[model samples]
Target: MSDSEETYKSIAVLGIGTVAAPLIEAGLLANNASVLVITRPSPKARQIPEGAHHAAIDYTDVSALTAAFRKHSVEVVVSTVNHEALDVQPAVAEAAKKAGVKLFVPSEYGLPSAGHTEGVLLVKSRFVDSLVAAGLPYARLYVGGFIEWIPYLFAINETGKFNIIGEGKAPATFTAISDIAGFLAYVLTHLPPSQLHNVSFRIQGERKTPRELAALYGDKAPLVEISEFPPSVKDGAFRKFLQVAFNAGFASTGYDAAEGKDDEKRAGSSNSLWPGHQWKTVKEVLNL
Candidate 1:
């Protein structure tokens, strides 16, 4: 089959949150793919996008999820479930398997988590294990960090004071949310099963140090070196851990020396997978 030919005609997006929104609009729906947004039965109404189907199922019930997948003839299952709720993915994988789904894309749009032992990374790793155990073909996407969340990740407050975690010298990968969604939809529709199955696509739109990132804002954002994260921060402990990981260089698309030479060597950024597309940079996105 030609690369331009759509391999998966029916695509089911598991959530309608931050990531799923663009994936449905610019990515899947724009490409003219049959898109289905799957959400848990909610009392509140959801504004599902036009040109897409919506299925409200009890996510905890594997049989119900399986029926929904089968009813829509879903070929690919793209999960955008929040990291905290990733424990529910194993059951989702079971349903996908039972429904004979072609591919399973888990909710792993963050820093590399191959050998993580604790925190949400560990939870994501376990979900991949479940996919393997269930014998389901899967694709894992690692984009380091979303460009839209840079202010929050960098702890840059309203007054433009940037918190310098560690030395703020470690380089980290950043991709615009639109690029992440666009790239995902492109590859899923264009690439064949041999290239898509059980593979990790490490992509980055831009790479920059925290200091450099702050510098992009010029005099508007001043850097403040801090020994610890502020107490007022929401999810302070988790966010602090992520900052530490970024400082240790785990937040880059490329392999870091701190990870040890003996560690499993990861492939370099797969940004070329989507050839000829101009990737959005931090400066461009922030208008800096």
Candidate 2:
């Protein structure tokens, strides 16, 4: 790609839920990039942002998806589809490759998928393999858990009460949804494809245990431990395993003290990489 084609002037997004919403907002903020979303056909009318574009395509049909990407001249494909729609990622990757998309951003904003037994992680790993095999340029953002989801996952109730599944001292990596979205937008538009490809772009807002987080909330909220809630590996046991997994340090934890600074710098894929931005820690977010 030459200087004329090096920039990602147009982007295609795959979903429009919580994660995708902020991404789309960031895209619209970009000076030269045009945003387009591939939405599923709905019987009722659907709402879309004013400046951003939309295309209803059968994600099952790879050829149709390819045509849509080519028609829009989408340089980067940012997929923010939910876990339930993960099956369509390979097809999306294949279509992006066929359409000559410069970069493909897969929906992998969570824990590292290298050696996890969790079903969701396995699915993510497989999709990443497909991208590598297809020779597509891609960026994987391993943002651990979203801070916004903490309340719902920890069984927090409307009265500002919550429960920890086990001992409340397990530290987990968490990033605010807004920060993740902003970083994605920045990388897709500013970073060159050569640098963005095959990169594990990570950013975490806070790395704290549940007990620490509860303490930050102070008297306004109380935390309880529900020891009876056993971890399970059934179909929808992601949260259960997540609690135990973080407790066991299953996610990528930079390096040991003996490993030295080089490894620590590599492992600490953090917000410091991006300038002029303030990442919110638990204390900052909870007003502790």
Candidate 3:
């Protein structure tokens, strides 16, 4: 099919874990799109979401994956697999290309590679390189972090507090999982390939610091000092690194590393891209 002829009426998504769950829901909600979740062969049955279809296949096998895509007439493929399964994404992309899929959304929903430490981030960056090298048309969504997991990231349940990684004032991006999924649905059905391909769509529900977040939650959540954080909480001494990184302007999009060479003054948001869609703020998410 020609690029212009490609329309996302039927799409296949790999995995239905945390991030994938909402994406599946959103996709199914698109009245015109038939959303299918691709799972590994049975003996392990997963509860398929209502209004969606499920298929079992050896996703790692490119030939099988391509066949599955062709069978489903999957015009678009979205990979929302977890970080550990990220290595399999390139193969998925390769299969999509072979199957003549028009668009691919890689599994990126966190910090931009520039802000990540080594390991997983490196693998993700390499995946992007593979996409470019293989000539695959893809969209990489960079959402700073999931707001739903923020409370746990800071261990709010046990300590009722979280550390201020940086100055505790920078407006770091955070998107509710539901909002991310909803936005993904909007993009898939509404955006044409010309608007969807080869882009870093940065979005955020709201940007707030630990201190500001504490205010919303009141005394229930307080800001703790990184110095007092337990040893187990240390992400390879990441606290210090993130503190420096966030202040150095690694917090949000619209960052031109060359322009002014200032990270603090940099800011941008794609929330305005879909003006009709309403986003959830941290306050609404926490029910505060």
What is candidate 3's lDDT per residue for 47-140, written digit by digit as tens?
Answer: 8888888888776889989988898888889898887689789788989999988888888877665334366666877787788788887887
Top-scoring candidate (lDDT): 1
**RMSD values, in order shown:** 2.7, 3.9, 3.3
**Higher-lDDT candidate of 1 and 2:** 1
Q: Rate the local accuracy (lDDT) of all candidates.
A: 0.83, 0.72, 0.72
List candidate 2 segments past 4 Å from native.
1-5, 158-160, 228-236, 251-268, 283-288
Tens-digit lDDT string for candidate 2 (200-267): 77677777777877777666668867654434412225666677665554443342223321132444
Query: Which scores greater on TM-score, model 2 or model 3?
Result: 2
Clashes of each: 0, 0, 1
How does residue 252 of candidate 1 score in lDDT?
A: 81
TM-score sort, best first: 1, 2, 3
Name the regions of candidate 3 deviating beyond 4 angstroms: 1-6, 114-117, 231-249, 256-268
Question: Which has the better TM-score: candidate 1, or candidate 3?
Answer: 1
Candidate 3 structure, TM-score to reference = 0.85
